[model samples]
Target: MDKVQILRKISQIFFFIYFIFFTSFCLCFFGLIEKFILKGSFGSLVLKLVVIIVLTLLFGRVFCGWMCPFGFLMELSYKLRAKIYKLKKLPKVSEELHNKLIYFKYLVMILSLVLTYYLATYAFCKVCPIGFLTNLYGTVISLIILITFLIASFFLPMTFCRYFCPLGAFLSIFSIRPLFILKTNNNCVKCRLCEFKCPMQIKITENVNQKECIRCFECKSSCKKGGISFSIK
Candidate 1:
């Protein structure tokens, strides 16, 4: 492998480990803040908002590809799905449909923000499967949710990501100008490997700016012709 590939592989490994700790810390740290910090402090909420905005502005969906527990789980499910169903051979649809489905994430974002504004809570979190994954494991509801998620894994490729994940939705919109993104130059081979490998179903060549790209770099790794590149500006 070239130096770039080696570096990217290392980064992916680092992201996996860091995200495990990061999500755990965020869960626990925020829990402590909720327990100790006064709910009335508008400053606390403002501080968190600022942090999220800055992080999103700087990194884009790095958090989605690198830090989200749900994204992690979906990736895990992909492996298991491959083993049981051997779905790697399934035929793909037109690139146009793949691109169109990406907009669903934005709809989810709007719903989440509107709900948060009117109800003072994100409805997805109240029932998010990832929240269940991180927060509950052995309870009846957790077990039920787990079964539901596993079953969904059988039918849908990254079902929650394609359709219902609010966090993904949030990242999709907020990371419009991410610090890093995949850029295609005229290396000139439309092998379409990247399109097939992408978990989010993005048309990387035609729509690099699409909100659904999780920045997982799977496409870059799969491209054998060296036709694809990642850049930050």
Candidate 2:
């Protein structure tokens, strides 16, 4: 394989192994408590947050695009969909609707926090598909919900991430205008191939550091003209 393909494969494998051996090993919360009540005890969640945010500031949404075990699972669903439907990737979503729907994740974050405050429990955890995906010893209802979310991914890539994931919302808050970002560097041929390849449906030709960008770096390889590159600001 070519260098770019090799690098991408290596990245995916490396991060997937990281997820299996580390994040899942820590029960998927990375030791973060869902409720504020548990904040008194020192937890790995704090250190984990610092590390993830620091890396995100340096490299842009590395957790969501690469290191997230759920993200890796969602990618597998896309591959299965392609094999069944005979398409390169999942269907292209409308830019207008996709943009609007993405905002829903923020609402989910707000509502989750609000409900947790009143309920004195991490109410969102009951609905958190990732929580269920990781803690398989939980309720049957949670398993059903996670299954539903996984099934939905076949129709819409990152269905939960783009619309309903509270954690994704939290990350995007810090990820807005990350110091490191993708850039065109004047090499773009305006072919729009990168746009088509972007899972976030971002108009890469028009904007590179878009908040919706998860920094998967797939678009970098899609640029046959070598237009895209990562840069630190």
Candidate 3:
């Protein structure tokens, strides 16, 4: 890995440790919003959410790339799958199918919020993988859901982030046109290495500012020709 990717990995590790041991609340945006809606109150949690939204507006989904503990676990699962299977290249969903599947996360976001509001309960949290990871839930359903998503991640890196995470869907609203974005320069040979390396499976050459981009900088680091760079949009 290049220096950028190495630094990103270290950041991910540091934040994952901090999240597990230092933080008390589940940082999942969906969960936080649900609680705020249910309680109809504002406090430190809402403040944190506001800060996250502002940061996302400026920097894209850096939390996913460098901070989210569950995202880190999913990435690990992807690497483990590659190692165990001795895969030369990770499998990728077709672009057409990928485009269609991305909408599912938005659907999840809407359904989860609406359901939580109408049902007067945090319905989605019962099955949220992050809740399971953070020991917020200990039921059989949570365990099953966590295992299912972990297996999906093993087969398709970032399957949850790409097509199922409500938090990602929520954050995408701000990240879609963040101030900073990945861009390609004249040096690009269209080798498509960056797209292959992107865990979110973003079509970097076509739309580097894609909402699904997690600001991981994998695309930048993977470009041996120095074709890709993160810069003001």
Best by lDDT: 3
- In order, the Cα lDDT scores of the candidates are 0.60, 0.69, 0.82
Instruction: Residues 96-213, candidate 3: write the lDDT tens digits.
Output: 9988999999999999899989998887887777665566754678778778888999999988888998888889998888888778888899989888778888777776745888
lDDT of 1 by residue, 1-233 (tens): 55654664566566556544545434222222222333445443456555665766776666566555555666677757667766553234456875576667668766755665567653444555544545522245544665676567545556667766656676566787777657776883877777777776666777676456766777787788888876675
Best by TM-score: 3
In candidate 2, which residue pairs clash?
none
Clashing pairs in 3: none
Q: TM-score of each candidate?
A: 0.70, 0.84, 0.93
- For model 1, the superposed segments whose C-alpha errors exceed 4 Å read 1-24, 27-52, 83-100, 117-122, 136-146
Model 2 ranges off by over 4 Å: 1-24, 27-33, 41-44, 88-90
Evaluate model 2: give its lDDT.
0.69
For residue 217, give model 1's deviation from the true position in Å: 0.5
Of 1 and 3, the candidate ranking higher by lDDT? 3
- Candidates sorted by lDDT, best first: 3, 2, 1
As for model 1, its CA RMSD to the true structure in angstroms is: 4.8
- Which pairs of residues clash in candidate 1, taking residues 3 or more apart in a chain or in different chains? none
